[model samples]
Structures are given as C-alpha cells and as structure tokens.
Target: MTLLALELLIMAAPDCKGNSVRGACGYGEFGRDINDGEVSGVSSRLWKNGAGCGACYQVRCKIPPHCNEEGVYVVATDYGEGDGTDFIFSPKAYGRMARPGPEFQLYSFGVVDVEYQRVPCRYGGYNLVYKIHEKSYNPHYLAVLILYVGGVNDILAVEFWQEDCKGVETHEKSVWSGS
Candidate 1:
C-alpha cells in the first residue's frame, strides 16, 4: 500500500472576484472561473517569478461540519490584499471549499483555517498540460506561471495555443477560516 501525501496548515479568506482582470502574474486573462486550481490572488508582494503566479495547492477546511477528506487544488492566478491570509480563493473556489451547506453558508464563510499543500498538477489526466490564455500562440515559448510548479514543464505551461481552453482536475472541495 502507498501512503498519501501530507498537507500543510494555512489560513485563507474568501474573495468574490475570481477572474476579474489580467492577473498581476503577467499570465492568463480574465473570464476564467475560480473553481479548481484557481486562486483570486495572493498579494503582488508575494508574487514571485512563478511561485505565486500559478502555484498549485490543495486546501481543505480544518473545522468540523465543513471538514472533508479530499480537497481541491487552487492555482494562484492574481494578487490580493496583503495580510496574514496566504491565498484568497474566488467565490467559486470558496463555495467548493467552505462547509457543506447552503449557498449562503458557503458564501458566508468569509474566512477559515485550512490544511493546504503544494501538489503535483495533473491536467487532462496528463502530467504535462498547456493553457492557451492569449491569442498569441507559441509552443517554444512558455509563460512564467510554469515556474510556480518548481520550473516543471509537466504541470501548467501558460501559453497561447490558438483556441485551446483548458483547466485542471478537481474534487470540487474548497478553505481557510479566521485564525
């Protein structure tokens, strides 16, 4: 038998905006839903070359009644309020991560404590996947978002592939509460 990965504990907040504008990360465009593998932002200050831009993470609710076995992978898309909160998930992400309840209860979860971990990304069941965020198509050239996965070309390659709309796999569970 194989042992599963161990997750780290972190704090998160709910951000209504998911894909508002072109992220400060210098990659990806707006109109993308903040469902799985999508983070509203993490504060531009935290925005590094490729770390905060498209870093993949699995965040789970730490509190009961909202606790879940499997969590969702949220990708860092843009930047948000610079505070103790590490990542601010979009409403879609929040709805999935928050306690299992009505839409209001899910949305009501302004903030919460969650267990998170950096995980290897799986796109379309492929270890390596590419995203066409812009019309400027380029196969040789990749975006900085790939750096967030530790310079791995196997997870997310932010590039324009001429009408290729893509995303990651998710359990739909969504994260953090007050500290």
Candidate 2:
C-alpha cells in the first residue's frame, strides 16, 4: 500500500484576528460539524489575537474508515481578527476536503499537505514513473509513484522535492489515485 495521501481543509471563526497563539495567521473555526452517513462529530476550539489555534483533526473518508485513507482538517481562528475576516482552509487542506472517499490516500506534513493535487509525469524523459501535480501554495511540484505490490490497495508512494529549470523554481508533486 502507498503511504496515505490526504488533502487538508481549514476553517476559522470571525472574531479572532492577527495570528493566534500558534504564531500562524489564518481563519478560525469556532465550531465544526462533520456528517458521515448517520454518524456525526462536532467540536470547538478557541482562537485569539487573529492567530491560529494550532489544532488539527482527522476525518475518515472510507466507508469502513481505513487506517491509511484519511484526511486532516485544520482551522486557524485568529487570521483576520483585527481586520475583517473569517475562517479559511490551507490550499492543500481545501483540496482534500473537496473530495471525501477512499478513492485516494492523503498524508500531511507540517502545515502543508503535499499530496493534495497530483499530476502524472514520465521518468528520465522516457519511462513512466508516476503522475505529477502542482503545489497549491507555490510554483513547486509533487510526484506520486506507483508500486506493484499485490494487495487490495495497490502500493504507492508520494514524494516531494524541489526542481530548478531555467532559473524558474519547479517541484514534482505526486499523489496516489486508487485505480
């Protein structure tokens, strides 16, 4: 099986402002509601000074909730505190939240989820290694390589690295697309 690929979604409350205690500036989620079939989970976190709460939550997408196929959701409540603002999700998280299913895997590292958007590419300009996708934040890229290991969930790997071409910074982005 490939390492989990996840997209991150963020939401913030309106009252917070100017970066919260987490030293990050973004939206805040005073309240959250997740509906899965007939089951639901609700939680609340605090945001102060337009700062981020630094809280992360996981939401399962699989019908039975697979251990590997899940997404991480984050909310920065203090983003637009002093200024007029509301909740916002990181580009990486937003992309993941948009799709809820076991069709793909998602993994998160630090504040960024590199596996959010994946595009395919060729290896050594000849062999087909995997797909490549652009990072939501910067012009960089990510790559998702496929492994033929015999299993219900075919093995796949996601890798992130920086690439420089003609003075332009480009990276390879990849994610597992359960095919």
Candidate 3:
C-alpha cells in the first residue's frame, strides 16, 4: 500500500547528491551507489524504525510540464525528519523524475509537490544480503543490516535462536528495538 497518497512537498538535499553519505539507517558507504545512486531518505512515518530501510517507492513530482509521468523508483536507504516533507531525494533521483529539458527548472523550484507509493524492489536475481555491522565483535555482540529486501513487508523485528541443553526450547530477543 502507498504510505502517503496525498501530495506533499519534497526536496532534494544538496549534500546528499554524491556518495550516499551515511544516514540514520547506518548503511554506510554501501548505500552510496545502490540503485545507481537513485536513493532517498524517508520521513519517520515511513522509516518505521529502520524497517523501511530497504523499502522501495515510486515517487513523482506533480509539477506539470516540468515533471515526467514515469517518475523515479527509489530505495529507502536512509532516514531523516524533513520539514513538512516525506522524502529528500538524491540529485540523481530527483532529476530522473523531471522531463527532459525542464530538469533545471525543476531543480530551481527546490521543493516540489510529490506523491509516492510503496513498491517492490527489483534487484534482478540477487537475493537479500545481510551485512554484519563493522562494530560487531563476534561473541561479544552481533549487529546485522539486511540489504536488498525485495518485498514491501516491514521487518519489524529480528530474532536469533540457539539450541541448548534446555530441550530444544526457543530463546527469543529483539535485536533492535523500535522504541
């Protein structure tokens, strides 16, 4: 389902143009080139406490003549609270949503009215990847970030289980807490 059906003002972050600088999602350098640098930072409502990290969305500006109908398909690689905005797209993603000759015009507007919807991510034949956080030091602690999660489902929580002398009982704990 579309997270926000109503049109809202969204802008492109000047600093987020190149090398997907780390954001709240902690994807680090790897997020830089994801989807060919066509990525976006979503608001808290859509961020869903990191569950929206790898979610994909189809976003298009509503500006006539300056906007293209196809819109850009972007992955939520980061999170940030915008000023009355739902997304802050990278330069590439923002320009991709504009018509051929009016890209500069669209950029001049800075903030444009937009509508976005949650969509399935496409990564060809690649499966979901789990990247162990660099800070993890094995038995001491483990932190994993899921990448390329293709579906629209939210990863509300992650659980780790172990088989012990407790007669195959399950031990459950939340790896990351939303609260």
Candidate 4:
C-alpha cells in the first residue's frame, strides 16, 4: 500500500484587511477579502468526504475564533491508497478524490478562494496552488514536505516553525514518515 501525506501553512497579519476575525486575513485584487464563512463551509465538506476510506481521506484547520494574533494557519491532508487505489488531491479545489485503492495519493497546500480554488505560486519548476490573493505578500504558502509511504504499518509525521530573516518571517519544517 502507498500513502501520500501533504502539509500546508497559510500565514496572514492580524491587521490585514478583510475579515480577519473569521479567518479572512487579507484583500484580493478584485477588492474581495478572505471569506471565513465560505472557507469554513468548504473545509467542512472536504473533511466530511475525506474521513471515509471508500472514497478519500481529507482534513483541514481554520483560524481559531479567539485567536487575535496575526500569524499563519496550517492545513494538512493525509491521503493513502491501498495497493491499487487512485487518489487525486486537487490543489485548485483544496480537496481530494480517489478510487478504491492506494495507488494515487497526493498532498499540497494553498490559500483557498471563495470558490475553493488554489491560487498559483511558483516553486521548484512547478506551480504551488493556493486559495488567496497572489499579489500581496500575505505570506500564504503551500509546501509539499513528504510524498511517500512505505507499507500498511507506516506512520507520517509533520512539524513547522517560523524564522525571522532580514525582517522577513518564513516557515520551516521537519517532516518524517515511516512504516
């Protein structure tokens, strides 16, 4: 069996425009801010569908209501396909779909839009899909740490940290997976 795990971190300033209280931390080019209601609804649906193995596995975390601090929200999705399963993690939709096996499993990160789509970001020859406005340095980033799984007895682990460099803050990670 093959399992694919993905972890993503989305950061935003508390003072950022839009509805920060509800997880919408910044504004977009169209003058639209992150819509907390929309993100939560979509995330809930994704988790609901992800919990069942007959289809796919999915999970999401949104900004907490009591969190008044400006920072990043980390969202992680762990997808596993049995020996013949096929799973598709659509970065654009911030969701995943799969057949009844463990052959095709993928993980990704990004800021989701009101429509639950990923905004494009450039990385190592591929586009990092996100759901937030691409223009502003909202610091919303999606990183694919580990994409491999050994056998059925394997476990995946992921961790993150923030670093200050040249007046800029960026996230770092230490990921490990084994059977």
Better of 3 and 4 by TM-score: 3
- Which candidate gets the maximum TM-score versus the true structure? 3
Candidate 3 runs further than 4 Å off: 1-21, 164-179
- Whole-model alpha-carbon lDDT for candidate 3: 0.68
What C-alpha lDDT values do all the predictions have? 0.47, 0.27, 0.68, 0.24
lDDT string for model 2 (1-179, tens) is 23333322233324212223232321112122111111111112223221112222344333234223444343322222221222234334333433455223422321223232111221224333232322233444323322111211212233343442222221111123221
Alpha carbon RMSD to native, model 1: 11.1
Encode model 4's per-residue lDDT on 1-179: one tens digit a residue. 22233333222233322222222111122111222211211233332333211111223323232111221211223232322212222232222221123112311223321111222211235222223223333455433222122221122233334553222221211122111
Residue-by-residue lDDT tens digits, candidate 3, 6-42: 3433444555452344466666666767788888877
Off by more than 4 A, model 1? 1-17, 30-37, 43-46, 125-179
**What is the descending lDDT order?**
3, 1, 2, 4
Best by lDDT: 3
Q: For candidate 1, lDDT tens digit of each residue in 19-123?
A: 554555554443245334355566444345334555666777655566555656677776666335666766666556654665356445566666666665444
Estimated TM-score per prediction?
A: 0.55, 0.21, 0.80, 0.16
Worst 10 residues of 1 by lDDT: 170-179
